[model samples]
Target: MDKKLIEELKLKLLEEKKDLEKILKGFAKKDPHTPGGWRANVPKYDGGHMEEESDEVEHYQNLLSQEASLENRLKEIEEALDKIQTGKYGICENCGKEIEIGRLKTYPAAKTCLRCK
Candidate 1:
């Protein structure tokens, strides 16, 4: 891969990481127990109506799902950045082939080529 192209992808991955962290911070906190882990904030409980409590539980569940998704994406971005450092960016992990430039441009965090994916 061209050094310049790799640099561009690295920037994209960094930007994505920042954006994901920002979104996660809105409703989640970093988990000190696990590196790169996030925990969705549980809604506060008070002496309230049963219906309201149910709604809060539902919302908390939704947040948990979203947090998991965002964290997975962030992990992929981090892995891609590490690959860049190791001079293995843009190579498909499954097939050991060069990933299509277009695919990499579309998703810098991609781990597999379109075929493998």
Candidate 2:
């Protein structure tokens, strides 16, 4: 892969990582004991109305799901950046083939090429 292209991808991945962390911080708290882990904020029921409590629970579940998804994607991006640093980026993890440049541009964290995927 071209050095310039790899640099560009690194920038994109960093930007995305920042955005994911920001979004996750909104309704979830980063786990102090676990790296890259987030826990959804649980609203205190405090003998509140049952209906409102149920709604809060549902909202918390949705935030937890989204946080998990974003965390996974961030992990992938971090892995891809590591590969780039180790001079192993743009290689398909499944078949050990070179990934197309266009595909890499579209998805900087792709682990496999289109055929392998």
Candidate 3:
């Protein structure tokens, strides 16, 4: 892989990591007990109004779903950044082959090459 390409991918991954963290912070709280972990904030309801309670619960559920998805993506990005540091980025984890440059450009965190995927 070209050094320039690797550098570009690193920049892309860093930018993506920043964006993911920003999005996660909007609807989730960082768990103090867990490293790089987050939890969706539960909606608070007042006066025990049944309808309002249900609405709040529904909103909480939606946020939880989004949080899980974002957390997984963030993890992958972190792993990719780590691999870069170890001089192992852009290799397909499943096949030990170089991942296509186009794929790396499209998804810097990809763990598999086109054939392995």
Candidate 4:
């Protein structure tokens, strides 16, 4: 892999990591007890308004789902960054081959090449 391309991908991954953290911070709190863990904020219930409370619960559930997804993507980005430091950034984890430059450009965190994928 070209050093310039890997540098570009590293920047891209860093930018993506920043964006994911911003979105997760909006509705989720970082878990102080667990590194890289996030907890979705539960909607506060007031006066036990049954129907409104139910809607709030549903919205909270949706936020939880989104939080999980964003966390996973953040993890992937972190792993990719680690690989970059180790000089394994563009290598496919599945087949031990160089990942296509185009695929790396499209998804810098990809672990497998197109064939392995």
Top-lDDT candidate index:
1
Candidate 4 matches the true fold with a TM-score of 0.95
In Å, residue 95's CA in model 2 sits off its true spot by: 0.6
Model 1 quality (TM-score)? 0.96
In candidate 4 the C-alpha lDDT for residue 49 amounts to 75
C-alpha root-mean-square deviation, each candidate: 1.1, 1.4, 1.4, 1.3
Q: lDDT by residue for model 1 over 36-91, one digit each (tens)?
A: 59988879999699999999999999998898899999999999999999999899
- List ranges where model 2 is wrong by over 4 Å: none
| Candidate 2 backbone overlaps, count | 0
> TM-score per candidate, in order?
0.96, 0.92, 0.93, 0.95
lDDT of 3 by residue, 13-109 (tens): 9999899999999988889675549977777778697988888889888988888888899999999999999999999999899999999999899
In candidate 2 the C-alpha lDDT for residue 77 amounts to 88
Tens-place lDDT per residue, model 2, 1-117, is 789999999999999989988998888888877566877788778888889889988987887778779889989988998998899999999999999888998999999999998
The numbered model that scores best in TM-score is 1
Candidate 3 local Cα displacement, residue 111, angstroms: 0.3
Overall lDDT per candidate, in order of appearance: 0.93, 0.88, 0.90, 0.91
Lowest lDDT sum, 10 consecutive residues, model 4, at: 32-41
lDDT digits (tens) for residues 1-117 of candidate 4: 788888999999999999999999999888967555988887888878789888998999999889888999999999999999999888899999999989998999999999999
TM-score pick, better of 2 and 3: 3
List the pairs of residues colliding in candidate 2: none
